[model samples]
Target: MANSDMCNSVGASPGAIQAPPLPAFQPRSCFACRRRKVRCDRQSPCMSCTRNITDCVFPAPGRATRHGSTSAQTPKRKQAHLLSRLQRLESVVEILAAQVKGPAESGTLELDGAGLVGQGIGKEGRGSALDDKTARLGEELGLLVIDENGSVYIGNQFWAAFRDEINQIKQVFDNDDRQGDIYSAETSSLNGSIPSDLTRQRREDSLLFLFWQSRGQDVPLKDLHAFPSQLPIIWQIYIENVDHYSKMLHVPTFAKRIQDLQGDFSRMTPGMEALMFAITMSAINSMSNEDVKIKLHAEKSDLVARYRTGTEIALTLADFINTTELDVIQAFSIFLDTVQTMESPKYVWSVAGLLARVAVSAGLHRDGSNFPGMSPFNIEMRRRLWWNILFIDGRSGSDQIAEASLHEEMFDTKLPTNVNDTDLDPSMKVPPITRNAITDTTPILVRSEL
Candidate 1:
């Protein structure tokens, strides 16, 4: 009985003293709150945990050991680092938006043959669009249109057609078979040869011949004299040619024979005056030495004294040479004689040939060469050939001339020779021979074989 009482007193008796049960673990808020050293409310379905805020996770029951504490803190530290990274990302997005909304807007982007927004399109449409844009740009810049075709023709289409018609006229003039005759025999035979009294009739016949030769297009004879303002640009060129030629023929020539020409000289008109001045200037220029400054000055002084004309008279004569008048060559020859009292040896044949054509046009001769004194023409042709040689000599250097001379000799001898034999050394310069030296030293009538 004493042992039983002692066991009860020491809680050895059954159910005398039982140890208290451990308290159940209640999870706190998330790991983020704990790492931040903030107070966490021990709640079920915690606000941070339910919101997927893993940073606020609480420790598990019986995990309050030293190892458990370190493991819990690691997760909390990672969650806190991740939150800081997310906040930095938000700040970057806001800064980018602010920069984009600033004052400097994007500049205009330029594209090449393909326009802006060059996306899906057919090949043909793309090509056409590019061409249209190019053309528009060219027009804006005032640039010439150089397409696969040729130059742009913005004027009347009639002028373009008329140009084709005039080209045919040039072809007729260039014909070799109709060498001497201005008018074909077939046409001349249709119209009888009228006397000088029928001047009006002759003019009409000439106008018809000109029209027929030029593409046989129908136009009024009256319209030939006064071309219509509405006529095409090409026809304008023809009309101008006709007017100039008509005026040219009416100009009287200086007396071929002194006694028979006095009456003609007395009846001189404006046309005659212009013609005479042109002829005199051509003659003077043909015979003039390269350095004929003294002669030109003297002629100017004489013109001022006798004709009381300005320097413009000489300039006008030069302008006339470029004209398409039928009598230009002959008129120029006559003028040449008047300038230098000496006969022209340079252009006599060309003048004769041109005159023969004029005479044939008048139904006087079908062959111009049949006219008397073809000797002067022959002489002039030879002189022109030599003149060309001298001109070439003046322009080329010594080495070029030496090579040319050697080539000529080799050809003449019909032998093979090296270029070295020609002595084409550029170091040796050759002074040009003066035009006066060529004219004075060379005999105009010299004839050599080969």
Candidate 2:
């Protein structure tokens, strides 16, 4: 009676009670779950196993507890626990999918040749999605593509890719060779080296040809005479070149041309005299030595003598004006127009002073009665006259003054008589004695006031 009472209290039927049989294990869930740490349902593609997305497999039937009694309850307990774990996993996967696919998908998706559905690419066929994307990117950025076979090809943007690939290939080849001799030879061949002197000569020849073509028959000669004032600028270029290249080559032709130009200035019109003077100054500045200077000065003296003789024989301003040609007048006008606007006021003043001396000698302002309404004391008229004389004398220079004096003496059939030594600075010194000098000198015809 006592035994029966104890069995009843423990809820056993006289003997120990056997546990109920556990469900069969499945291969679709993990062994840890199958051992009843969690349940592995015998579902083919089990819900707990599939939802967790792990490599699901079962442990052997006898692999649980030592008595084998716990094995019967293992599957049931693991299935229940796995069901709860799977529910949590499914929720986590849903949260991840939502996070990945958010507002970005609301906009239009760009599709390339790759089989990518979203930002995460999916591979299809023989080529991977990554491979296809790489190829597309290489093409866009003008990169070269190297195949699995070790062959190279211009991916896209053909020219740029081709150039880069070629350069890289060359660099590799160059490294293998180690000696840069081949590269140097190729570069030399491509560039075709030339001597610096030859290059300079070629350039100068080209410029000379151009100038010759533009100037036609006139070239050096006509240009020299046509624009007497610009002679200085022209001479400057020649002089600079001569100085630079003197050791390399003699410029005898250049020197001869310069000499001829100096001679030509004497015959220029009175209007262009200032331009000639400027040219003379340029020649003086360009002379290499004292001998050249003296020669130049002597030539100037001869030119002045001829010009003076010619003008003095004319006897009247009309005669002088009539003797002048249109070309001479035009040339003179062109020169004056250029120099009048020059930045150097000294040049202007020098030209003006020279002109004043010439006009006074020419009898253009005798008793101040020649020009209508002009006064000896009229500053404006005097200034205008001064400018006119300056323009002429500056272009002609002292040579022209000497020439006029010589002409006057020759026409009168006498030598210059008034041989006074003028003060070097008119305001600073008295005129020198002339009586003794006049005895041996030729007589210069002095015109009376009109």
All candidates: TM-score: 0.18, 0.15
Highest lDDT against the true fold, candidate: 2
Candidate 1 Cα deviation (angstroms), residue 211: 35
Model 1 gets an lDDT of 0.30
Estimate every model's Cα lDDT from 0 to 1. Answer: 0.30, 0.33
**How accurate locally is residue 53 in candidate 2, as Cα lDDT from 0 to 100?**
79
Residues 310-407, model 2: lDDT tens digits:
22221121122222221222223223323444325445444445333334333222211212222222222222232333334434444434443222
For model 2, the local distance difference test gives 0.33
Question: TM-score of the candidate numbered 1?
Answer: 0.18
Tens-digit per-residue lDDT, 1-450, candidate 1? 899898668786566768554233233333554455333343544555546555434445433433223343243443454345446445533532332221222112223332221111113322444455334322222111112211111112222333433433343334323212111122222233355448544453443331112233343322222112212321233223321222222111122322243434434332344444343333333333432244344443333223212111322332322322323333433332233222233233333333333322221211111112123222222223222222222223233334332122111111111112122222324312234332222332121211
Q: Which one is best on TM-score? A: 1
